[model samples]
Target: MKLLKEMIHPELATRTGRILRRHAARGIVLREQDQILLLFTERYNDFSLPGGGIGEDEDMELALVRELEEETGARDIQVKAHWGYIEEYRPYWKPDYDLMHMTSHFFVCDIAPELAEVRMESYEVANGMRPVWVSIKAALDHNLQVMSRQEETMGLSIQRETFILEKISREIIF
Candidate 1:
């Protein structure tokens, strides 16, 4: 995978400590026109890609497929391309590490016409995470709105999601 972008938290720029690393695989499931699959997190008033952290010793593509199924109830998922990756260095929320580094791999994928009930985790359910096929611009605009307001409900993933949404808007072919 190629490095699409790298972002470093301002707080981590001059600070140093034990940095824990994590990896995630995200998918871009595009339909005809502007529709794209995404997770609409109501609690945060934001949207994110349908994917999650890669398990230890798991293949990235497999992780993407599994996550898509779990998060979006996607069927017949097929990863067609290694889109790119984004790297993020931020302050860790855990006590064990002072900072964290994460790489988010992205892939373009295809899914069957039908979907089933999502099997999201409890936290995701509590957070009102639901799978939806939304206009790429709608998700992006909504995320940008929440970000601009600096809402406390906004999650850290919103920024990354917004970035990818913008990229998709620009690069997605008609």
Candidate 2:
């Protein structure tokens, strides 16, 4: 896929540079034992997959690994599939940019099955954030307030989820 600069709105190109200092980024959804791992975010008090902004000139997969480790204290990630992309929108509350949005590359991943040690970033999740393992069925609901907040930041409206479902559906089934 083309970089966001090549494909996005012209306005995004002009203002994004000055407004947002951070560059492209990626994230991951790690699954184990029919459940998915998620982190509660401090910024919005939302439940989201572990992720973060990509640094300058960083590769997408490398960014994914970095984010997963920083947010979830996870290591040795084994990616399963590319779950597609999300055009993340930074609402007015965000202070890091002149632009009001970002784009993210997302993937589905897996780690060790049993409960292994986790190292949560205390600063990132002092109270509003914590690692939670939820069943796939429960996680798919995406109805709670935290999830809604997560949806907003992650650009996870209905259409995005639908696309992700379509991408992963075949692999999930026989």
Clashes of 2: 2
Off by over 4 Å in 2: 1-18, 21-33, 42-45, 94-98, 114-122, 140-142, 145-174
Worst 10 residues of 2 by lDDT: 2-11
The lDDT of each candidate is: 0.90, 0.53
User: What is the C-alpha local distance difference test score of candidate 1?
Assistant: 0.90
Estimate, for each residue in 10-29, the C-alpha lDDT of model 1 and write its tens digit. 65754468888899999999
Ten contiguous residues with the weakest lDDT in model 1: 8-17
- TM-score for each of the candidates: 0.95, 0.60
lDDT of 2: 0.53
**What's the C-alpha lDDT at position 7 in model 2?**
26
